[model samples]
Target: MDVAGAPRRFTGQYYEQGRDIFTDVDQNTFKAVGEEPVSTFSIDVDTASYGFVRASLNRNVLPTPDAVRTEEMVNYFRYKYPAPASREQPFSTTVNVFPSPWTEGRKLVRVGIKGYELPSASLPRANLVFLIDTSGSMNAPNKLPLVKQSMLMLLGRLDADDHVAIVTYAGNAGTALPPTPVREKARIAAVIETLGAGGSTAGAEGIRQAYELAAQNLDPDGVNRVILATDGDFNVGITNSEELKGYVEREREKGVLLSVLGFGMGNYNDALMQTLAQNGNGNAAYIDTINEARKTLLDEATSTLFPIAKDVKIQVEFNPATVAEYRLIGYETRMLKREDFENDKVDAGDVGSGQAVTALYEIVPVGGPRAFGERRYGTRITEAARGNDTEYGFVKIRYKRLDSPTSRLLSTPIDRTKEVASFDSAPRDARFATAVASFAELLRGGRYTGSMTYDDVLKILGKTRGDDAFGYRSEFDQLVRRAKTASSMARLGS
Candidate 1:
């Protein structure tokens, strides 16, 4: 879809196979239309916008799906570093950025991969098994072959003592290599090169073997995970969701985590990947190309592998006296019941070392002139609550030690007047979060107030464009202009 009169290049470089997938839509605009005007095409994912270009083929060819999801795309955005929690010899810094939201007809959206620092002291010895899909379906350049290259990039990030393993699935799953030290790069590289497509996918068996290796080589005080690289189409044995989920759950009890790293497109099963990741006590990501593999493995390696906090659940109790209604943005799927917060069995999000997660709630005033109508009328408040009618809500965080069951609680209050005006007035990190929320609102049709249009979003982003440190904020400004122009042209065409 053309947003601007023509597509304009942003901060990041674009790549294509023989430049066949991309086409000039208008002036500076370009879209990936595929060979022979087909629907599907090879794609490279990045930290921005999931590196996906959606469009149609001109003739009879079916357009292939781009596997990247925007959630992971937004997560890939660069973040400004913050002061480490410890002060005595701990790292700390203050970051500030200038606002650069969209303007006139341009649209800018800011998504943050929030500032996270990996302290050498807190780094863990890792045991990682890369379970790859070598089925015929992975013949696409963006599939199995790309998986090998991506794993190679990740291999470079491993320390000498770290253990790496390899497993493959097709007609059957087997250990391509046992857990080996990272220093043995030559052997690892050789195994990767030997992989090729042939049989049907046996994802379940592959996972089972991978977990067994991880358990045998488990790093009790370190990161132990199986990184499954696939197109997410699990055929063969244990293909059904219930059985697959059950397997992961049982293995997780053995303290072996799973990181579902999806590759390629066509028949991409987002639901399956999401389910496995959530159940496996890990995160799921889609890699559209090699560069994305670098970002996930190199730049954000710590967050993807090691968990600083586990089962981290957030509970905010709204004060009936101070607030009428509140709706959390973006985390609808992450929400927990009031009782679930106290239940240790229920799983929640994991926060990596130095990783910062920000959540926002847009609330309507209670008993005020600007209320969004009554949601509750003189209803008796539940006994399972905590508040003294002094603020909007109590923000409570519950987390567990990576291996422990008992949880810890951290509570903070939302003082009413300490409102963050525009993106500029907030901390660099908070501003970044504001941009993400704004963008998500726009994408979801802005169900709540402040679902600003593309122009408005750009305005917010432009004003908060912090130091072009990672060039992420700068790229956002460019996206704004492109979006504005495309939106306008679309309107005129209609």
Candidate 2:
């Protein structure tokens, strides 16, 4: 245990700050469009980073730069993009380019993808295993109790066709409730309410048992998932990340997906949870409040439970004649090698029903200020090779159906025709998403957010705050105010 008196796994070293376990990779750097014209990365739908940042700001502390993944922050909110017309494609992509709000002479390109939405009555039956961590570390109100309430919210959304099981891990792993139909809500709630937190965390053991239960009660034509709710402190058994990941990988091959629901703040192993969820071909979400829980499990139940596309990847080829330098705004960790984009065996991110994923890129058009210094020697595009003045880049997406081995391809050309004259003239969703991305960059040290301040972000957000049906945008406004106050306090302390 650290100074906070919270129970933590006995790792090699004991840091006084128990929250030191949170980990993230370095950010992406600008790439010259002349040298590397193609940008490829897997689509990510995880919303944990945004929730984690919100949790930190709510506590009056600034989140670490690593904790702020700008892409995840932007994708957390639902955008009003049109869904695909048919399940044959599963998703539709929309691209828009507008003047960059942060950089003076550059342009911001937004790529949006919306997965097909299935009616609630049309959703397939589900076999869900709740892997709850009842270790001593989860003794707080924000951990075990919150998890119970969140599970209850999910239970309310499930129907008679769904089957539920509960497994808890402490010093040992055991089944709290056997595979029971959703119609037995009273019995399920009873089992959940009886759960109490204590003992060490055998997360790996719990996972193995949950997978066994999930496989035993598998739904051949429906969703089979293990939802692990924990603070991500795994110890007592199979503590090595590689070993745990290997176990998850093997289980995922049997058609049992895994999604992680993170709770608590101190000692949260975000990196491990992300790795497990990614390897298991599922999504990860951080549950900070009951409202967030409802948003994840109830409001977005179809998307949260039913995946429409798997291993989705986007590769954009920028025309060197139109753009001189480019950099993907976020998704540093989701970057894929050019070769991996064509390799179907390579695992990527998944898109669920009605889920919308977005990616942004900052580009310096030819004759504009280059992100990096000019290349001493490079092949120049001639007038003929430059193609027409209307085209900007080609966007290609590859994804495999949930049950297919081969991947299908979709392509579209982004052109000057789609470019809006100014940021203010852009679509409301695009403008608001850009503001969110800018705010995220500001929170992550603002190295690239030139001349952009908190007030500037607030103003942009205020203008673009459309009809927020669920009040998510309003919550974002409150977070911005909190961040402003937090920044002021930090400056004073410094």
Candidate 3:
């Protein structure tokens, strides 16, 4: 124990509705127990409200085949915005990696970019319906009220040519405003402001009404979407999970995208929001503050409204000889089946135009013959005498055009014999990603093979801070200090 009276250890975790309980064991390990163990989870290193988890695992306790995907892990790294190649341009790639807090000599990888390729936002006509949940649960200061304010902000940003509608749900769903041109800003603001919170949550009915409004106002060449803002609490109608997923999936086929912006806390359903966004061919974001709303709706406006690639999947094959044992840092839930890479129907992440996605792998150099300590040498019997002349496997990416189902493939070779050390030759984005990953591990309980710590992670990140254009690097350093202090406090608590 060092300072703040918290335990310095990773014992285990037990999570339930609205609360997470962690037990301290040693400084290195933890286990989750309560309300079932969630596996697929997304965390915000900056804002703490929008954490997502899908803990569905089989009896074997390993992540399901469809649950693990490389892109999910890489996309999960959210540090350093991709720089625009030029002030006039919109997309640039940035990569960063920092030392792992749990694993010695290993690093966390981050790849990101600011995408300039704003899809043609010039939709001939856009029919946007807002599905809002105004239940009593959303009475908090940051709940429905903030949502309304945010919508108003978006309304202010709309063009006169765009069409907008509003649908609200409490015990039942109903449309408060019909489709109208952006010229009627006053009327739209009036309708939005009049929305009040009451009754129990009826998310399904709201979804139905929003989709109906969208389908009725389908824009042949414009953007037709149902933007659902809720805390994902469904008590009245259409509560069945699979049924809702199917409904949203079918609606997506109509060329109407779904964008889910989750608001509020307490009983927040990250799983439900994720499912809705994934199946609806859209993205999910939790709005904890007004700044987040501005970032999502205003700053990254084009990408949020238009997509460049859909169903993006990444596949990386490692040479058995070059890497002894490897594990993905985060995205423990988005792992993919090896064959699923070629399957087009498999749902994957979407990449906005000019968006830079990055992933990293901790590998052991084959040429150096590093000390692996024979962890799995005798665990499995030898199969048909595989040769040792293997080289680095290929890294492949698959993505479909925003409006098409067919996909395109991009592949790059990973030279096995080259044995590049990540610490020395890592790109800028890689270094950033590494720092983010390390920071995440340190924040959560990281029990890794590398024996990395928060102090080490900060050192690595500081060296490759890059241009610090958006102050993200400065923010990162602050987070590092906070984490270090928290760890010390936890130690003291123990």
* Clashes per candidate (backbone, < 3 Å): 31, 0, 61
**Model 1 per-residue lDDT tens digits across residues 209-265:** 999999999988888899998876666777766678788989988888888887664
The estimated TM-scores of all candidates read 0.75, 0.95, 0.75
Model 2, runs deviating above 4 Å: 1-17, 382-385, 488-494
lDDT of each: 0.58, 0.88, 0.58
Per TM-score, the best of the predicted structures is 2
Q: How big is the positional error of residue 426 in model 1, measured in Å on the Cα after superposition?
A: 3.7
Q: Cα lDDT for residue 19, model 3?
A: 22
What TM-score number comes out for model 3? 0.75
lDDT of 2 by residue, 426-455 (tens): 999999999899999998888888999989
Question: Per-residue lDDT for 1-494 in model 3, tens only?
Answer: 01101231222221223221111112311111111111122211112121221111111122212222334323433445645554233334343433433445543333343444653553245578988889887888888888988898888767887889999999888999998888989999999999999998788889988999888888887777888888776767777667888999999888877888877544565556666787887776667567667766776555566665667766655444334444445544344566677888887766554455555555433332233444443333123213433443345666676657887765544543333355647555565566665555444455453566777777877777877655646655765665454443322112
The number of residue pairs in model 2 that clash at the backbone is 0
Clashing pairs in 2: none
Error of 1 at 180 (Å): 1.4
